[model samples]
Target: MQLKEFSFICPVIESAVVLKAIETVTSPDAIAQTLGNTDSVEERKRKLPSQLVVCLIIAMSLWSSDSMGTVLKNLVNGLSRQWTKLGQYWKVPNSLSISAARQRVGCRVMSQLFERVVRPLATEETPGAFLGELRVYYSYR
Candidate 1:
């Protein structure tokens, strides 16, 4: 609350968008191939496809919270460009829809995708990353 205290605080700025980082780490095409979750089935008429759902799940993991709906809305706001490019206006799916979509993708597929995509985000020099002689990695999610 004091001017001297304020002067000691440095302004932090984010130089990257999370969606861009996600795209660099993994792509929808890759997820589709991994899960066989292509949009080939025209009869389902699902607004939320398996690929997008997979990304949403990953995004949810990144921006973790007690509420899935909150995570999804945040994902939508963060990755608005990707959704807008799909030729349809995107809206955050309801809890039921999210559940259904997740079920449609199946837990097995998600597990596999997570194994394939998730990686250690810390460098060897990061604090407390190693205990004794063993190398350690931390997962934020």
Candidate 2:
């Protein structure tokens, strides 16, 4: 069949349901609430803001393709754009900077952020149908 002859549009009902589900999963308030409780002070120096760092960590997690090197590379490529958008308050760390940040904050912070933000986002029932598919495909195997 020719490309033009085939229907390309998704059904409106499915699309609306899917979109609403996605919105619930990625809601900003959910993100803020999840990251809000992170400790803000360490060794008497201010740490990166929990909310901002959580945002960065989430982006990094999404970009990572199964390796630390890949995550660093993706962070470098998108760093400038993200920094520009987030303003001076958000610093895009270099390779060394990432190493330092990781050392300073440790893995616990990132792990907590993931559990708080990404986990809930994945589990919200409105979004569960799509996430169920992903879990079956990626997690169950």
Candidate 3:
């Protein structure tokens, strides 16, 4: 179905609010500042601002998948299809590639992205209830 034709069963938070929150937290400037004085080569890739990489990692974490293999499988069977429909970038990677990328990218980058983007976009009490609950539940588990 076209994105415009799909509707949530419940009240939905505004995408603008979520995007704005992401922008506020993950601003290029903020990322740059975080990378400052760091010797890591991964930090230099900030010049690219890889939305696909960030989205995949966040998706994996949100889905409560325990391993990169599971994450990659889910991405191929689930998220990639949606992303393709939305005209967003998505790719299926082998387990080894997924592991390599995850290791190279590291949790620090994902943590910072979550802190800056997803955290603020979360509901006032928590923004998207199901999403928030899932995140909290998965995080502790």
On residues 1-141, what C-alpha lDDT tens digit does candidate 1 reach at each position?
Answer: 212222213343121345656666676656766776433322565667666777778776656644778766665566647543443566777899998888777777777767877766545675787787677854533
User: Can you write out model 3's per-residue Cα lDDT over 1-141, one digit (the tens) per residue?
Assistant: 213333344365344333333334445455444434232235444321334345456555444535655544444444323232433354455666665665655667656655654533334464344553464333322
Global lDDT of each candidate = 0.63, 0.43, 0.45
**Model 2: pairs clashing at backbone N, Cα or C within 3 Å:** none
Best-first order by lDDT: 1, 3, 2
Instruction: Give each model a TM-score.
Output: 0.61, 0.38, 0.38
**Residue-level lDDT tens digits of model 2 in 1-141:** 212232226433233233233234444455445444455324443334333344445555444443544554343344434222344454444566555555655566656545654542233354443654564223421
Error of 3 at 91 (Å): 6.3
Best TM-score among the predictions, by candidate number: 1
Ranking by TM-score: 1, 3, 2
Those runs of model 2 whose alpha carbons end farther than 4 Å from true positions after fitting are 1-50, 65-92, 118-141
lDDT of 2: 0.43
- Look at candidate 3 and tell me the lDDT of residue 136: 36
